[model samples]
Target chain A: MAENLQDKAHELAKALRESDEFQALQALHEEVEEDDVASRMLSNFRKVQLDLQDKQMQGEQPTEEEISQAQKQFEMVQQHDVISRLMEEEQRMSTVIGDMNKIITEPLESLYGTPEDEQNQ
Target chain B: MAENLQDKAHELAKALRESDEFQALQALHEEVEEDDVASRMLSNFRKVQLDLQDKQMQGEQPTEEEISQAQKQFEMVQQHDVISRLMEEEQRMSTVIGDMNKIITEPLESLYGTPEDEQNQ
Candidate 1:
């Protein structure tokens, strides 16, 4: 029974991963919660974009100090406290939603079960 | 938005608690998991039942020592270690099941969502 339960758990996990619902939730989640890791990843991209915009506006080269400051800011944002909180919330929401599903399905089977069986010894 | 989210959480909880599935699951659970707290509560009841059954078979009254021994055994069973694990498993299973439902439902919306909108800022 324990082995069967474990197998069921794996099957369930696979079904969830391939599910359209999982994809949709993941997409929606991407919008709702931004990752510090990814945001940190794109720091260089942001710096390049900012540098380009600055050059376009001022027609002046950015100083080494300015570039250094921007890098520091990018690093700080990458590990921002808010980003950490968002990650936590993301994890919590996932657990909450999963629990809600179980609440919906498995519990109902007993209501329709026979009364004699209900009084199991 | 926080208030709305809180309200939704409450609604979800209420829906789950009152659900037919919840009732059925509760019943089924009663059969599978014997709680130590309740078992302790019914310790006296068990002693009475055993004493009555023994008297019927042996056609002899149970001695005070026999009753006391039975009570001690009942008390020990009431707080068995296995009951605690069952309680833990019950909680874990509830969370797992709820998570599965969310995986099944919310994620699908993104698969059907527009590609343009998918690239949200």
Candidate 2:
């Protein structure tokens, strides 16, 4: 039973991999990596993100200057056409996955029952 | 664009929810929740489980006695018919969702490229 479900999942992944949206995102991702300028820009943006995450984990808030710096880094990365498209595609993909999560957990939701505000959603 | 993908995801979730396997699991979950004996048994099992997780999070390894105690609690819960059925169903559902996650993450995996050994998987 588990093997069959896993097989089905692999098939689903293959189908999604072939999708235009996924393919486009993949192409853009590769493009970013191939361009030293764009890749460096992305790396810097990621560094800022990780630093903020690390600070939060340590119970420290990022200063206003740090926030502004991160914001500037994000805008700079967005200037690259391939990176811009990749970000948009990532957003679209995230939306679909997020929706799937809501559905996949429906049984749990029904069994435990959601809170009043969530139930309405 | 994002809305369309989200709508499609919702449709896919609806289809999964209507499947017989999902329905059986949901019914079993409700049955266990409604059974006083089974509910209490499962609660004890979960308490043991959380304690082990807490220990691990604190960089502590559970002693042999702790592991043995958790095993006893798990075995006790499995003796309950509804709880057993619910556990089986949860495993099945998790397998499907786990597969979906593999498919959903293909782009990220491609973009970052997994560690050399993990690439084969």
Candidate 3:
């Protein structure tokens, strides 16, 4: 029985790999990697973002200057076509993976129950 | 690029499905389904659980009687070995799936930045 279930999971994974969303994201990722300017900009943007997140987690609010700096960095990244496209593709792939996770956990959800979505009602 | 990412995702999914955790969960799910008494108990438990969740979502707390009834139902199911095993397997599977989700989303996490874990500091 375990073997069968594993087989099914493998099939599902295969299907995801064949999905267009994943393919597009992969392509964009490679493109970003190849462009030094875009790659550096993305790295810098991520660094600023992580720093802000770290501060917040420590119960420290980012200073106004820090927030402004992060915002400026984000805008700069968005201005680049390759960077923006990669970002969009990343979001799409994330959504696809998210949906898959939900499906995989459906049985557990039925058994353990989760919070209901009031807004969906 | 997108194609390549999709391929990687597919591979990851396949690996998850083939994992021992997934297999054990699948076997338990089958066992529960085949046992009439266990199956009924599980179905009833899920129904009551969903109802309680729905009430909460509607901004209504379950009555004391309803809470007691739900608790009793849970206790009854837990007494069954098959059901208990299924529940444990489900938890294990959920954890496996949760980890996969985290890994798949790592790139996005790096790009967009998520809240840092203060406990890890």
**Which has the greatest DockQ?**
2
Query: What's model 3's lDDT at B120?
Result: 52
Q: Give fnat, all candidates.
A: 0.03, 0.28, 0.00
Q: Write the per-residue lDDT of candidate 1 for residues A31-120, one digit (tens) a residue.
A: 434665655544554567577678756657777887777767656644755544444545555665555344444334443354466579
Give Cα distance to truth, residue A29, candidate 3, Å: 14
Of the candidates shown, which would achieve the greatest TM-score relative to the real structure?
A: 2
> Candidate 2, clashing residue pairs?
none
Q: What's the lDDT for residue B78 in model 2?
A: 78
What is each model's TM-score for chain A? 0.31, 0.82, 0.87
* True interface contacts retained by model 2: 0.28
Query: What tens-digit string does per-residue lDDT give for candidate 2 at A2-121?
Result: 444444445445555666677777888879889999888888888899899999777688999999999998888788788888889888766655655675566557665667755586
Better of 2 and 3 by TM-score: 2
List the candidate 3 regions with Cα displacement exceeding 4 Å. Answer: A1-121, B117-121
Tens-place lDDT per residue, model 2, B1-56, is 34444444455556566666678887887787788888888878877898999998
